[model samples]
Target: MGKKDKKKEKDVGKEIVKDKKKKSKVVKSEDGIPIITAASAIILIGIAIYGYTVYQDLAQVPEMPELDLNVWWGQNTTEPQDTSIRPYRIVFSDAMESEIRWLFEMYRRPNKKKSFEDTAWNYGVHSEAFAQFFSYWIFKYSFIQRPKFLNKFDHFKTNIQGLDIHYIHVKPNVDANTKVLPLLLLHGWPGSVREFYEAIPLLTTKREGYDFVFEVIVPSLPGFVFSEAPARRGLSPHQMAIIMRNLMHRIGHKQYYVQGGDFGHAVGSNIATIFPNDVLGFHTNLPVNFSKLAYLTWVFGSVWPTFVAGEHVDKLYPFADKVKFLLEEFGYMHLQSTKPDTVGIALQDSPAGLAAYVLDKFMIFTDPANKNDPEGGVQKYFTYDKLLDNIMLHWISGSIATSMRLYKECIADAEVEQVFSQIPTPVPTWGLRFKHELAHSPDFVLKWKYPNLVGTTNVDFGGHFAAFERPEEFSSDVFKAVKAFLSFKK
Candidate 1:
């Protein structure tokens, strides 16, 4: 009786264990749905959050404060708005002159062991060229006479956006009945209003083919020279464009034309984009595209040369080589864009350092190949006096640091990409491509970014400093652009 009872108990236990194992297998196969569903839900939520953040970032446009011009000019409430154009002259103090002279005299030359090739400007500013320029600065160049030469143009300072905006206003001495159009000529880095000195007379004088003459107004970009440095940060090119438009308004120019190269191109683009109604037309020598589409456009354009490069396919092709060149040339940009204060302090302290820093850009931008030359090819395009005069403007103003800060302030702005690519300039646009422009984009590439581009001219002689180097060609191209704009309007 005990044996039968033990066997029955064992069989019942085995049946119970087998049933539990079957249920466990079912759970492993079918019960994992909720876990998988939960994981998928978490992944979906993460993606949604990331996409929203990117959209918000891309959609935001930076807001700029509007400045009251009348209040800023220091006019009392009772006094009538002093819109009167007062003549302004550039006068340097004795202390400033002495300081500059001392700095030049005390310049530290490269070590005796340093060869010209070792100090090639392609790597940075060549020591040899800096020595020659320094010699001219100390012995031959006259800062006093330079201002007198600049004074040949009518210079004026007007308060705009709480900053003293200095500009050269040249009117054609034509009959009162002759149609005169206001032209705002903007300059970029390593250049100043001095670049336009030679082109002013050509622009103001009426050409035979063109009926209209340009009343050229070339302003020192804020913080460049006479124009006051921005009191606060975040004064991007967009803000400068606002100040420029206001200046034009204050001068009774409801509508005007604009042209620029380098930083000026960015500022003019902002003007044309933000104030399309006021900017009748726009032109630039250096046209860049910052859109997302540019990547694809560049890729396809590289293979099919004519699509973007046109006849300049040879120059624009071999895109990798261009990238390599850019990487080499972008050291200053990297430094300035990130830690401008570091280099700024060095440049501000030493005139020779400043000359090397500033002149390096002029040399490379004029022609990157010039770096191989011991003189950086400076003598071919720019005279010692002219180059020194340009440097003097930066030296006298002590604006090297402040001007460099623009790169730091504007580079990280979320709006820069949007403004550059998405925002199109609706006004008639023209492009003048010089042979030695630092970054040469073919006319077709330019047209893609500037949809309303009326025409493009590929000039053989000029470079980035086209106005300063080839004033006659620059003036003629400007005349052609203005004529095109007028014709387009008609």
Candidate 2:
């Protein structure tokens, strides 16, 4: 016989031997003939136990919550007791718009002062107060206002973990699937769930047979915007991970994928690590190296000095670079993380200050070359609607103080720790690198934070807000990573 035939015959012989042994061990009492009844009973019991195990494995998947998408598209006029609106409509009249235009024209006509810091403090104080006040007013108005832009999806209000989370869900028209892969998206500081609004349509669209239909969940970080702010202190990113995992389990998605950028990167990573069995994978724009020894070697070798020296053009970012980035890019972090109560007063009182403080991030976060090009930077990185939308969430929620406090709470215990330590994640990971992204390189990414990075792609287009700025590139790269992760099974 051929090798295949011989192997098949050997497997059959083994099966026969096993069955004969089981039959020979059957307990027969006073019966003259050997009792086959005892052997049959033993076989039945084994079959029943095996069936139950298979049933349990199939039963673990959670169900999707029934949500009404229309409520999100409708007007929201309800005013909560804790919040107040600032009167912006009273201050900047339509006539002021025309006059400011003429005033700027006259001011730029000839030689102007190179810089102005004479009343810097006074100006800053006034700006923050005005921003805080106006943010609330504009936000409330927009909440009830009609949306001019057209999109395929609708928004909804869902209560998760006793807190209200505003989310958006989309389903494709051409090839709708009853069940879809769940994708949870998380945003970082100075940003809200509004960041992914533009990419929702592109994400929900199908891609031939490989269409991994996604039921996307985008929740604002607690206290950041719409989500309820916790009154107690000491809620770290790890705690948030627990809440997210629970939310996933409660929502019937025991297995799901996650994506994050900025502060959300930490939360996403934490979720993957603490709940690896339940998580399918995790993706982040920011990946850091965990090994302190490796970092020190690079620092001593002089290859990782740009980040240390505060230069924006850094090749290998180290812990020192992270510190520098925080010191510079995070003025808000200082105020909110350190003395939340003191700064919250200024942001809550002044609308202009809030606008300047919040808008400043947009100015710095965009490509440096496009700083002066106002039309391009904000629009390119995030849409005009999204920027205004996110800012409005902060304004309307009146949680600026509470949100800033979260930074302080999360970092309180590890104030002086050099490296972040957490559980190892079994989830597959994907990293996207944009050319103009603030501080990211493959070497830096692998060295600083993310250790289990399975795929990293460098894209030619986009900047900080990769998903919003360049949807086509962002979606394609995201889908590619999804394919790679789906194919990898441990």
Give all TM-scores, in the order shown.
Answer: 0.82, 0.64
Name the regions of candidate 1 deviating beyond 4 angstroms: 1-85, 108-113, 116-120, 303-307, 414-417, 442-444
> What does the lDDT read for residue 150 in candidate 1?
69
Residue clash pairs of candidate 1: none
Tens digits of per-residue lDDT for model 2, 464-486: 76665666777777677777888
The TM-score of candidate 2 is: 0.64
**Predicted structure 1: lDDT:** 0.78
Cα RMSD (angstroms) for every candidate in the order listed: 6.6, 21.1
Q: Write the per-residue lDDT of candidate 1 for residues 200-255, one digit (tens) a residue.
A: 99999987877789899999888887887876667777778878888999888999
Report the poorest 10 consecutive residues by lDDT, candidate 2: 82-91
Model 1: how far is 324 from its true place, Å?
Answer: 1.0
Clashing residue pair totals per candidate (backbone < 3 A) = 0, 25
RMSD of 1: 6.6
Clashes of 1: 0
Q: After superposition, how far is residue 414 of candidate 1 from its true place, in Å?
A: 4.2
